[model samples]
Target: MSWLQLKIDTTKAQAPVLEELLETLGAAAVLMEDSADQPLLEPPPGATPLWDATRVIGIFTVDSEMDAIIEFLEAQLGEQLPAHRVEVLEDKDWVRAWMDHYHPMRFGDRLWVVPSWTPPPQPDAVNLLLDPGLAFGTGTHPTTALCMEWLDSLDLQGKTVIDYGCGSGILAVAALLLGAKEAWCVDNDPQALTATRNNAEHNGVGERVHVFMPDDMPDMQADVIVANILAGPLAMLAPVMAAHSHASTHIALSGIIRPQVDELREVYGEWFDMDGLAIKEDWCRLSGTRRA
Candidate 1:
């Protein structure tokens, strides 16, 4: 069946309200994208980030009266609605369409993030088969790539790893594939926990990776710790991360822009000897060892 798609370009501040208006106006589904093609970096914990200029698209039945709906929208939204367009959309394999944009990505050497549908580019390398979902961290972002590259350089065999703020469990699973004896995947969001679990199962490392919420995380020292959360939370999580690390623990942190590196180094320096920063585009990763 064909669907009527209504698209409206608006500011980030108005996008949420327009989505609600679309729902109230009988929209079956609504999606939002960046109108300016700006990439949204990872937000602080508990925050949902959006682009400055957002394009909202709502779908409805093609049989619906669009003129009357447009009139209602005009009344409710007025000048705030900006401009809109309506088009007919024929159903197709949306999952395939989305997956088409994602290809196998390699990090460092011998580590690959392969979409579940695609064959690994390097069969001899360690490949992580993943499906993108509600959770973040598919290795596409520089933050995730930095963490994976750090993980690749480590000797993880027989080590205990902690993937703090584990989104999609990609890092934890990668550590396992790299020979970590076990990994703990911790995140505050339930969807993140679910996504991590699902991805771990997909990689056949579910048994080796344990999932938890921050409040429920086990108290134990880990040989390695990796967190790709933003700088704000990383600053706040310093004590928590330190408490979970011993003098020998190796730590890697990402999701930091260049300007934030100095502050992060200062914050983590209390418990770790912060190493020199690694740059990927505008993003940076900080590696350090726990202080004795």
Candidate 2:
């Protein structure tokens, strides 16, 4: 099926607001990319990080009835935005575009986020396959790396873990591989549940990994909670995730930019005494133990 790939070009400053505005329209997928960040740039000797001056956000899968889409966005910020600003591009290969580029990637030591089409890592890494459809959680992103790295450092022996928003079941499957006794993964998307199930079986942990739909959790507290969701959900879930802990339970959180560390910390600070944190490429991972 063909999808409409609408490129709403805005200044770096106007991009976020526009992107958020597009969400109220009909965006199946939305993303912001820096125009100045050259895809063709080469590494340089002791060079400064590249600065992005322009912003491009893509909104996908709209119908011929984009009048509503246009009206909704324009209604809110029509005067502020550039005239004739919405440029709709046709996506002839939307599926292939994501599949071709979103390949398996390694997040940290002994952990491999293998894509569905790619062959598993050769011989030595802890392999975790993923199929990220519309949902989230692939280990290639730095936020996922932070959580995986935190999981790598811990001794998951005999622990029961909960992976909230278990997109692809990456964390839950990894927990079992890292020696957790068992894991339960929860997601609202049936597609994600299916992928999680498939990935668990692929990783040889299906028998040990239980998949649950949202609001249907098994009512048992876990020894560890790993949430790789965005900051908004992570903060909203702070109490619920913490509730999954007693005294000795561990927590690993990611999907937050470095600038927002303090907000996430404040959410879980009183409940957990932080163990340590990892920073890589502007993403942060935080882990802690729930206090008694």
Candidate 3:
């Protein structure tokens, strides 16, 4: 079925009201875009952030009465929208559209995170079968890439690994596939747990990849710990991670921007002799061994 897409430019204050109006007009879906090229990053939990100037779009069945819909909206709003346009939208597979945008991405020389729908370019590479979903760590971000490179360089045969703040269980699953004996995956989000489990199962490593919340994490220490979390939580997790590490344990830390490196270095310095760092596009991955 075709859709009637109506886009209107409006102030932030009016966007919600217009969206409601569009819903009443029998819109199947409503989308909002920023008129200004502004980004909404790290919004407060459960809060919906909008731009100062927003472009609201309403999608309706092509057969709907567009004239009556516009007339009702204008009468209820008491003023016409600054700008508006209606266009016929041919039906397309949105899932395929999303998949086309995310091709198989390689990290380091050996590892590749390939979407389930796309074939790996390098057939001989150690490919990780993954699907981009609610969880993070898709291998597109520099932070996750840095960690993957470090993992590829490691000799993890028969080693036990710990993935703190494990999003999608990418690191843990990758470690298991790279010959690690087992991996303990920890995350606070329930969605993350589900994502991790599904991804692990998809990769045939579910049995070896154990998922947990921070509070329910195992008491056992690991041979290596890989944490790809922000600097604040990384710093706060210092002692907790240290308690889960031995003097011989190797730690790889990412999700750090260049400017935050020195602070993290000082914080983790108390427990590990942090290596210089692996720099990639303003992001840094720090690796080191636990202190004796």
lDDT winner among the candidates? 1
Model 1 regions more than 4 Å off: 1-92
For candidate 2, write residues 1-292 as lDDT tens digits: 5566555556645655666676766576565444653321211211221223444444565454556666666678766345334445554544455576677666556777776667876547777766553334566666666778778878888999999877767788888988999999987766568768888898788899888886888778999898876777788888888778889888888767778788788888878886657787877777788999
Compute the lDDT of residue 15 as modeled in candidate 1.
78
> In the order shown, what is each candidate's alpha-carbon RMSD?
6.1, 9.7, 7.1
Candidate order by TM-score, highest to lowest?
A: 1, 3, 2
TM-score of each: 0.73, 0.62, 0.71
Task: List the pairs of residues colliding in candidate 1.
Answer: none
TM-score (C-alpha) between model 3 and the true structure = 0.71
lDDT of 3 by residue, 1-292 (tens): 6788898888878987998899888897776767762222222222235567788878888788988889899999998866999987777532344465578887776888888777888988888999765467677778888888899999999999999988778899888888899999998876578879999999998999889999999799999999988888899999999999998899999988888899999998998999859988888898999988
The C-alpha stretches of model 2 lying farther than 4 A from their native spots are: 1-104, 116-121, 131-134
C-alpha lDDT (0 to 100) for residue 270 of candidate 1: 92
Which predicted model would earn the best TM-score? 1
lDDT per residue for candidate 1 within 80-143, as digits (tens), equals 3488888888774333444666789999987999987788889999999986654678788888
